[model samples]
Target: MNGLLEDARSLELDRLRHDVHDHPETGLHLPRTQQAVLGALDGLGLELRTGTALTSVVGVVSGARPGPTVLLRADLDALPFPDGPRHACGHDQHAAMLVGAAHLLAARRDRFAGDVLLMFQPGEEGHDGARLMLEEGLLDTTGSRPVAAYALHSSASAPAGQFSNTAGPALAANGTLTVTFHGAGGHGAWPHRARDPIPAVAELVTALSAVPARRFDPFDPVVLTVGSVHAGTRPNIVPAQARIEATLRALSDDTLARLAAVAERIAHGIGAAHDLEVRAEYTAGYPATVNDGAEADLVGAAVADLFGAERFLRGGRPALVSDDIGRVLAEIPGVMTGLGACPPGRDPATAPGNHAPDAAFDDSVLPDGAALLAEVALRRLAAADPAAG
Candidate 1:
């Protein structure tokens, strides 16, 4: 609202957010989303670099003096919900913020002394877009691999304008599990003849919970939730096969490994006890996003510049959520800060999460977000090499 931002960029941001909300594309294959971001970066008068591992867009903004480069990123993908194209996770807002930052920096290009790598990455919603970008050398071979990088995620658990950032493990590591139980099909009348898998499936569901609760350490939180179950054709006939899908979360790698072992044990035990053949597959997904202590402190200081320290608190140790940004941090030392964009005047216990169909974002602090991102980029650019200017 103050410093370098202007009215034109703000208007453009509104349009961009609405446009993305109206036409939401799910995950990695976001053509329209990529195009929209491309247009925004192009309009900002930056050199656009496209086709970085399927729809990932990168733009470079050069400063007046020569110095180390910094990367500013925003994800450009939506959920695959049948319930209309909604910006459930407020990614539209993230795109708008990055676009706004690009505009702000471009408007006052002489203030800084380094290069800015503005990335509009696609497929962050469980598609591993960050991994894809990294695989294609998005960060590597680039100018210093970024002396520092920054990205913002809008949070619905807190109020608007008030920001909260975690210094350590901010998000959880997740793994997707798919288990199928197979058995002989027969009529329900003859229980002894039919090798029904229904009981095994039920037992598996109940047994999975024990892994994270009783077997694993109580202090180390890990969760195994069965989100979907499919089986049986009719009530009279016993089903030959059953499928169960679950999402697993853990704060630490050892916990994740232990839970995985426990899951396999439970599946085997249930299948043996119920006389059914069970196959369980655990696919390792996103890892826990661990923030660098120093980088997180720097981010907190930057946030304090916009909103005073009294309103902010360093986030908790970690939570049971996963982010593809973890892949980036694993490759390089960086931090992913959570922004309190949750609607005001509601308790977090009742607030909807990122992927919820009815999730909506409060736009009051969007400009503030834009300003914060711009300030982070400017501050990093200046601090990395003040002698350049």
Candidate 2:
């Protein structure tokens, strides 16, 4: 709706979103997605570089005057489902909005005094695409790392056109918890000849499930869910081993570590009670996304200005979902905010959320998202060092 993103550009953004949605690609090897991005930015006259380790694209737009650099990022990956890959997370919309921002910034480069680094990343689901881009020199593309960065993510369960974010701990830290119980196997008819691991496995599950409530403080929350449980195929036989896999989420590093420690201790203690062998593996994942206080204020102001003040909300609870952009924010000062794209006629409370097979995002928010991203970049760049008139 802004003058920067006109009707024609908005239509093109929708087209691009639909095109990308139709052919979704997961993980780091996204050649088609990368090619589509390059084609969209063909005549921007900005310096561009493709990823060597993964299919990432970094573009730099320099102002005629000198100032600090700011980074704008958009992830370009999809989550796979039972049938195939789908843009259930609305990553297609994220990429389109970034492209729109690139166009708007490229056209008005003379109005700002700083450089804008456009980062189009892949493998955000779990492969750490942002880390790979950093390894391949994403920050140095502009000759210096950015002073501040910003990224926007879409939500399928929020009111359309609403912008929400928190100043600190915008998202939780993610990790995995796996526990395997080992015991001796014997004939089902035998009389207490073998130690059955099934009882120990059940006890371990109960102990791990009760960890957050019984072990940690009530104010400091943690979530541990056992998503998978595996044991013997036949019902009659006593299995030699049983396994349980769970996902771990916490708001801080210390809490995450504590959660893992408690789970492992519980499993080992239960194994000792049952006189069986037990092992636990904790695989670390993305860190918690913490926003800089100043940068978060900038985002709130930008959202309030670009849209109405009513559209801007603050101090909401952070999302439990994880993102690799946290990796970048850890290294630089940045803020990652969420844009509401819930489809029309869907209630935010009852609608399918992101990563769900039926999740849907409204394309009407495309222009709003694009304008918001461009406006944030413009405001940040202008505040860095005023241009000489």
Candidate 3:
């Protein structure tokens, strides 16, 4: 274990992070990122497989001895925004950390048992790549289901090198909605001759915004924000069609369903009142990320050992953010923790959050992330075997 950590220390972790940060790819189109990961895993004793339903890659490393198969995952996709094209969500760091962990494990293959599945998934922002891979037979192709899985994210809120996890519902479920309003078009100078969609769209936006502020408890962490709306091509003429698009997030499946129903009803009512035809579409995205209790405990112990017990925080309520990795957690017993990537002395509120244009992560946490990940994988693999314990 010590030797693996030493190898991680010399792996140029920060340099790899910068290389990924400089060139960020959105969703399943991460060609350069895919190539880099494929190259990094070369020559390792693991059985490697690439090209799984759009740039998603999976590597399987089996130990000489028999034990439970554990899965470790990292997201390979980035956000669609220009600002996020850089190091916005710390995905570059995520890829580097996972690669480092895989290398560390391969370096010390004699210390553990069972197989470790390294999954680098894409399109986590919205495309549900993890679910797609599963539907394409990832679980079946891998033979037996993974006994446990583990994942982690870089946080700009906490100080560098700190680790945190929650026992239940670490992240929320996400849903996408789109509303289009159709109305009659007439001459601008004609009065009462045309049914206007602009008013309906305006009212719909206001109503959707009020859902979070008025309907749900603010402390409960629910979000319903309208990302885009388009109406009327010219100032003098009211267009016949108007479109509205939004993203909804909630901690539970019930909350998500209610939110969708509310949106549709509200949109329909507004359209009726405005004498316009309304069409709304809602699609369920990723489910909440819930960590397994036992696996979470194992990860906590490994984190505490590497960064002292004081730096480990295991009790936290779920956030409203959605993760594709949550799908992996649902199938396997596992936990996903947050690493403190926020620079020292910086207020997290003021720091750029994920998907923001100026979002950034502390580079000093690279080695710590690599080490913590390696330790978690080793500890989990060891614990799965009663004889090793």
Candidate 4:
């Protein structure tokens, strides 16, 4: 049999997955992980290049017949922790699947009619590694802009072997809100003696939370989570400044922009009313992971074709989590689909989410994910061909 199914059943994938997972590295500089990927891809005959700014790997597999290009991306970083880094997000699984795809695609290059750009990216966890790759000329690697780009993100929330995603906004655009109010410190005995920034911070937090309900439409969602609040050290002593850190997520950039503006306005207004200086810093994160409508349909059709209709699940709503893959999709026409990788036996509905210390993934999804991605690349390339006989 072919390497596609062979890799699926092959024990080597498990070994590779464990190799990467056991030695998880964080941020844009994952030398060990990059080396592991290189080892897995050695002697594959694909033209390879490492990133200038980060530890990214890009390989291209050209088909026998000349055609347009397609991109398949897999991130190569993990979540950082006090104890060290962890592959809690199943990026190791993602890497292994893409490697399997590389093998399968390379083995049968004459069957298709285009170049497959394999993008192994790093620092997907808020570092914007995809953006760095784009800046370093990701689309220019194959000499032709990809007709379509596709990526599979493993989800602990979904059952193993099931694929799920929504068209339009599949993932949220991530942003941050920081409001620091400057006030004069004073003793706890008298409130009028000092400007209490804590009260203003509290008000701004409430106001920012209400921005989504008032400014944004109910049909479109905007999530505002106040993650941290800092103020005085003691209960009795007033602080000179108080700050609130919040994370903002929206399905669209316009909504995120609107939310940021409204939140900043309310923050300054509350500070002004309190007669305190307010600094509202709004930082934009990754943009929304918008899936091309036709591409999304193609993904569902592909999953159904490969794994049967039971394997594909169309999500009713977009996920609020932000993804750097959105950076690539924003530049090219593509789709980002989530594959369920919850380890066997555990309830998928209750599986610990990615980034959690105890999160787990089943290795069996590696071959299936690889085969599915290869099939998608093949299908998209065939459809993109206008001169089909």
Best prediction by lDDT: 4
lDDT of 1: 0.79
| Clashes (candidate 4) | 0
Error of 3 at 224 (Å): 1.3
Root-mean-square deviation (CA) per prediction: 2.3, 1.6, 2.1, 1.5
lDDT computed for candidate 4:
0.89
All candidates' TM-scores? 0.93, 0.96, 0.93, 0.97
Per-residue CA lDDT of candidate 3, range 58-118, in tens?
8887776877777888887766664345557888889889988888888777778877888
TM-score of 1: 0.93
lDDT, residue 225, candidate 2: 93
Q: After superposition, how far is residue 200 of candidate 2 from its true place, in Å?
A: 1.0
Global lDDT of each model? 0.79, 0.87, 0.82, 0.89
CA lDDT of 72 in candidate 3? Answer: 84
| Candidate 2, residue 21: how far the Cα is off, in Å | 0.3
Task: Write the residue-wise lDDT of candidate 2 on 234-346 in tens digits.
Answer: 76788888889999998887788888888888888998898888888999998989998898888899877777689888888877778988888999999998999999899
Sort by lDDT, top down from the best: 4, 2, 3, 1
Comparing 2 with 3 on TM-score, the higher-scoring candidate is 2
Ten consecutive residues with minimal summed lDDT in candidate 2? 1-10
Q: How many residue pairs collide in each prediction?
A: 1, 0, 0, 0
